[model samples]
Target: MKKRFRSTNPVVVGLATGLYPFLYNYYSNFTLVDSLGQLCFFVAFFLLVPVAINICIKIASKKIPFVAKNYILLLTLSNLVGFASLLTFSILGPKKKIILLVIVLVFLLALLLKKQLKKIIFLQYLLALIVAFQLGFYIINNLNFSTQWKQLPDTILEAKFKKKPNVYIIQPDGYANANMLKKPPYAIDNSAFENFLSENNFKIYPNFRSNYSNTVTSNSSMFAMKHHYYKNPKPSSKEAFGLRKSIAGNNATLSIFNENGYKTSLLIESPYLIVNRPKLGYDYSSIAYNNLSFLSRGFDMNVNVVAEMEKAIVANKDQTNFYFVEKILPGHIPVSKSGSEGKEIERENYIDNLEKANVWLRQMITLITENDPSALVVIVADHGGYVGFNYTGELKRKVKNATLVNSIFAATLAIRWPNNEVPEFDTDLKTNVNLFRILFSYLAQEPTYRNQLEDDGSFLIVSQDVPFGVYEVIDGNGTFVFNKVSF
Candidate 1:
C-alpha cells in the first residue's frame, strides 16, 4: 500500500505562530465574529510571504538552479522569519538587543533544519492544529455571553425628571474609595481631594464598592443595573466575553438617556474602551485616534481627552448631554513586583498618578461649572488598584483577608448635583450597581424605582480556584463577608 503524502506547506504554521499572541491577548474582548475577521486578515497578510517566496524562486531559478530544487527550504526559512518577527515585536516587545538576539537565534535554528524540512512537516501541522483547537474552544465557551439586557426596565424608563440638567460621569480608573485610601494598606492622605469635592458641593459616598472587581465586569453591571454574580462562565480569568458590549454598546442606561432626549457623549483618553470597536451608543464619541496595532497595551499617545471634554461641553451647551469621560489615571499596580521595595515603588507610582488625576478632576470641574454651572457631574471609578497583590492571581492567594478583599472591591463614587439638589435616595447610594438607579429615581421624581434597585452585593471570582469560586466579598451594608458561592 502506498503511504499518504504530507504537504510541505509551512505557511499554516507561520500564520498560527504569528497570530497566537494577538488572539490570546484579546480573545476575551473579541466576539466570535471579531475573532474570525481578524483571523482572515492575518491569513491574507501571511499569504503574501509564501507568494513572494514563490516569485523569488521562479526569478532566481536560472541563475541559481538550487533555489527551485530547494523550494521547501526557502518556504521553511520564510515561515521562521515571519514567526520570529511577529512574536518578538507583537508580543514580547523586548529591547533592540533582545530583538536582535531573537532574530539571530531563529536564523541559526533555520540553518540547522535547512535539510530536514520534509521530516518536520508533521510537527508544523501539529502546532497549527493546536492553535485552531484553542481558538474553537474559546469561541464555544464564550457563545453564551450575549447581550442580556438591551434596554432599561419600564419603571426606570417611565420615570420623569422635572429638571433636565446636563450629566457628566468622570472616571479616574482604579481610584479607591475614600475610606480605603485613609486606612492601613493604602494609608494615604486623601483629605485634600475630599475637601476639594466638598467645596464644589459634591457628596462623596464613603462606603462605595463596585459590584465586581475588574473594569469590564464592574462597568457591565453598572450600566445594566443588575448583579452578574460573575455569570458569563469565564472562558478563563482573563476572558469575560460580551461585557465590553454591555458597557460600550447600546446599554440599558445609555438607551434610557437617549430616550429622555439627552445627547450621550463618550470622551476616552485611550482606545481601551473601544478596542474591539463595539457599537458605541453615544451620539458623539471623541478620541485622538484608534491605534489598531496587534497586541496593543491601550495607552494614550498624548491624546488630550480633556480638550475633547471641553469641546463637547461647549458644542452641546444648548442640548441636554450625558457625558461618560473615561481616563485611565492612577491605573492598576504594575504586574512586575519583587519584594518590599517593589511594593513601595508601585505604591508611590500609584500616588503620583493619583495626584495627576486630582489635577485633571479639578480642571474638569472648573470647566463644567464655569461653562455650565447647573450640570450634574459624577466622579466614579471602575474598581480598586489591587495594590498589594498580583491582580491576575488575586483570588489564588491563601492569605486573603477581609481588608485586602475589601480594598480590591473598593471604588470612588462622588456626585455633584445641580444647585445641590441631592435627592433622598442619595443617602442609599452605596454601590456602583445602584448608582444609576438612584440617579434615575431622582431624575424621574419616582421614589418607587429605588425600591426595585438590586441589593448592593459585591461578587468576585476566585479565578484560580475554578468551577465554584464565585464569592460575595461585600454585603448590602458595605461590610466584607468573604463567603464563597457556586459559580
Candidate 2:
C-alpha cells in the first residue's frame, strides 16, 4: 500500500476542494493570467490557514505529523466548513442552541478521534471539473472587466449642474408597483400612498419597471447608467461580484455626483454580500447591520434604519448640496396578511408593509421639504416581489411564460422635484437607467441630457441566453400592460 504520508494525492485533494467555490464565480471574469493568479493565490491562502493550525498542533503534541504527512485535511475542511456553514447557518443561525451543540459535538469528536479522522477525502475530483471548466469558460467567453482602470466617458462628466439639489434616491427592496398592489393575492389599496405623493408634488409612475429583478443587478446598472451585466454569449453568476464591486466602489453615478459637488451618502439596508463591501466616497454613511449578521449569512435585511437616517439627514439639512440613498424596508414580504397598530412586528405581510411604507414616505416627505424644499427625492423599488403570489388562481393564470409574470418587474417609481413637480416623460418609460439622465437633465439645466440617453422602450429581463421576460410596459386609466416577460 502507498504510504499515506508520502503520497502526493492529498495535496491534490486539498488544493482542489479549497478552490471550488472561489472558482465557481465568473462573468467573463478572468483571463488566463487572472484566473491562474486568483486560483494560485486563493489555494495558497486557504492552505496556509491549515498549515498554521497544524504547526500549533505539532508544537502542542510532539508526535503530531506535519502537513506533508497529513496533507492538512483542514485546508479542504475549512472550505467545506465555510461553504456548508453558510447554507447551514442561514437555516440554523436563528437556532443558536442547535448550532452551538452541533459545533461543540463536532469539535469534541474531532479531539477524540484525531487519528481516524485523518482520512477525510472529500471529492478529490472537484478540482478537476473546476479547472477543466474554468479553462473552457475562459476560452469560450470574453470578460469585459480587464485589470486596467477604466475612465468614465467624457460625455458623462461634460454636463455641469448649476444648482445641485439635495437628491435622495431611495431604494425600497422588493417593493412592487401600483399595479401589483391592485393585482391578485394581497390586493391592498395604494391610493393612500398615491394621494400622499400627489399631495407632496410627486409623480407616481406605476408603469416603471426595474432593469433587473435582483437588487445588486438593478443597482449596479442604475448607478453606472449602463448595463453592468458582462458581455458574454451567456450570462453566468461569476460576474456578480465584479458587478457588485462597481456598485460599491466609485461608479459613474457617484463620480458624477461627487465631481458636481453633491455630497453623496450610502445606506446599506439589505445585508447582501455587496452591501458589506461598500467603500464608496459617500459623505454620510449609515449601515444598519453588524458583523454578526454577515457571519450568520442570509439574503434578508431585517431592520429599517429610517429613524437613524433621519438624524443624519437632519444634520446636514441647511449647509451642503447632497445626494443621499437609503434602503428603507418596503415591506415586500409580510409576516402576516392581517395586523393592527400595536400588533406590529419586523416582518409584516405585504399589505401591512406597503401601508406602513406609505405612511413612512409621507413622513419622509415632510422631513425633506421642511429642511430642503428643493431636494430631488426619488422613490424607487429595487424590484417587484409578487412572484410568490403566483401560487394563487388569478396570479397563476396571469403568469404566462418564463419571460415574465405579469407585474413581477413592475416596481414602484416616484420622483419629487425641488419645487414639487417632475418633468413629464413619455408614459411608456419604465427603465431606471434613464432616471439619471432625466435627473441630470433637470439639475444641470441641459436638455441634451435627454438626447444623450437611450430611448425608453422594452428591455429584456434575461436569464443568460434565454429571455426570462421582456419589460414592455404601457399604462393608461389604471390598467396595466405587460410584455411576455420572465427570467
Candidate 3:
C-alpha cells in the first residue's frame, strides 16, 4: 500500500486568524472591508479547523491516541465561547443575527467531523498566539510614544479683562452663511439675515471657516484652541487607541476650560456625548432622548435636545452660565423619512425646523440679555451640509457624488459684544483658526491680544470635492481686507 500524507485544513485556520481583526474594524468603522470581511473569515475558520484537527490525529495517533477522542469536544466549546462573546458585544441588529447564525453553523460542522477537530484546535491556538502578539505590540508602541504637536499651538491665554462675561457658544450643525447658499433653490440672498444682525449690533465675520472638516476634530480643536494632528488613513489597532487618547486625554479642551474657572455645560445630540471615555471635565452634559431604548427612536435626536436645553435654561435662570449648545439641524439622512417627505415637503420641513430652533435660540438670547445685556453670544456651525448641487437638482446624483464627506460649508460667525465700541468692520474678515484666539481676546479684554490677533496670518484649508475658490468682500468704499473660500 502507498503511504498517505496528512495535511492541515486551510479553511478553519485562515478564518479564525482573520476574524478578530475584521470584527474590531467593523466596530470602529475603520474601513469598507469590515461589513463583509468578518463573516467570511469566521465561516472559513470554522470549516477548516476540523480538517486541521484530523491531520493532527493521524500524525500523533501512536503517541497521543487520547487527543483524537477529546479534540472535537474542546474545539466545539472554544468556538461556542468565541461566537457568544461576539454576539454579546455586537451593536445588536439584523447584522448581528446573521453573524450569529454563521458562527453556529460552523461550530456544528466542526463537531460533525470529530476525527479532524484535533488538528483544527492546534491551528487555532497558533493563530491566537499571533493575534495576541500583534495586540501587545500595538499597545506598547502607542502608549510609549510621545504625542506629536504638528499643527497646534502652545500656551493659549485669554486677554486680560476687567470682569468675567457670561459666554454662550452656539454651534448649529451644517449651517452655512447666506452668500454661500446661492446655488438656486437652497440659495438665499442672506441679505435679510445680515441686515437683521446689523440692526442688532452683532458683528458678523462673514468669512469664518471651520478648523477641521468633521465634528470630532473641529469641536475638539475649538475647545482646545489647538490644531489637531491625528490623521491616520489606514489606522492600525495602535492608531485607534491613539485617536481615543487624542479625543479624551488630559490635554483636551474641557480640562483647560475647567482650569480657567469656566463652568462648562454641553447640550449635544451626538452619541459621542455618552461615550464612556475619560472625562474631559464638563460641569454638565446632556444628549437627546436620554431615556429612549431604541436606536430608531434616537433619529429625531435634535427635537429632544432642544427641549432639554429649554428646560435647563428655564430651571436655572439665576446663575451666570457658560453654555456650549450643539444644535442638530435636519441635515443628516432620514431627513425625508423623519415624517417629512416630498420635494416641497422636505424644503418646507427643513425651513420650519430651522425656524423652530431659531425661536428657541432667540428665547434664550432674550432671557440672557434681560439678565445681562453685556453677555457674549458666539454663534457658529459645526460643519455644513452636502445637499443637492442646487436645491431642485436630482437627490440621487448628488448623493452618489457627494463631496469627499469631509468638505463642510463655511461656518457662520455672528458675535454680539455688550458695552464696547464695536467697530463697523464693513469688509469681510477671513477668520478660521483664530476663533479661539479671538474668543479669548474678547473674554479677557486685553487689547494686546487683539494686536496679536491682527498679526496672525492664517488661511482656510478645505479638502477636495468642495467648490474651492477664494472670495473677497468689498465695503461701500471697495476695500478688500479679507479673502477666503466661498464654500
Model 1 lDDT tens row, 206-298: 778888877788888898888776664653534466767678777778877988899998888776766555666778777522354433445
**Where's the lowest-lDDT run of ten residues in candidate 3?**
396-405
Kindly list the per-residue Cα lDDT of model 2 for residues 7-118, writing each as its tens digit: 3233443444334433442212232113233445445544554345444543444454564354334433433443333223334333666666655555555444334433
Candidate 2 TM-score, C-alpha based: 0.70
The whole-model C-alpha lDDT of candidate 2 against the native structure comes to 0.53
Question: Better model by TM-score, 2 or 3?
Answer: 2
lDDT of the candidates, in the order given? 0.71, 0.53, 0.47
Write model 3 residue lDDT over 1-487, tens digit each, in one string: 1211212233353345345533443333322122233346434443345445444544564467585556445445445445343434333332556666766776777567546544554655664566556655554553333345323443444234454666777777666545444443345445655676676667877655554444555555555555433232222421222333343334434454555666667666664433333334557666422342222212333434556556766765666567777766634223233343554444455555555555655655565566557777777775544333233222212222213222233566787776755533323234334565566655555444444332222222322333332222222122322344332
**Clashing residue pairs, candidate 1?**
160-444
Model 2 segments beyond 4 Å from truth? 1-46, 63-119, 122-143, 146-156, 228-241, 271-281, 288-304, 331-348, 387-404, 424-429, 458-487
- Candidates by TM-score, descending order: 1, 2, 3
Say what the RMSD of model 1 is. Answer: 3.8
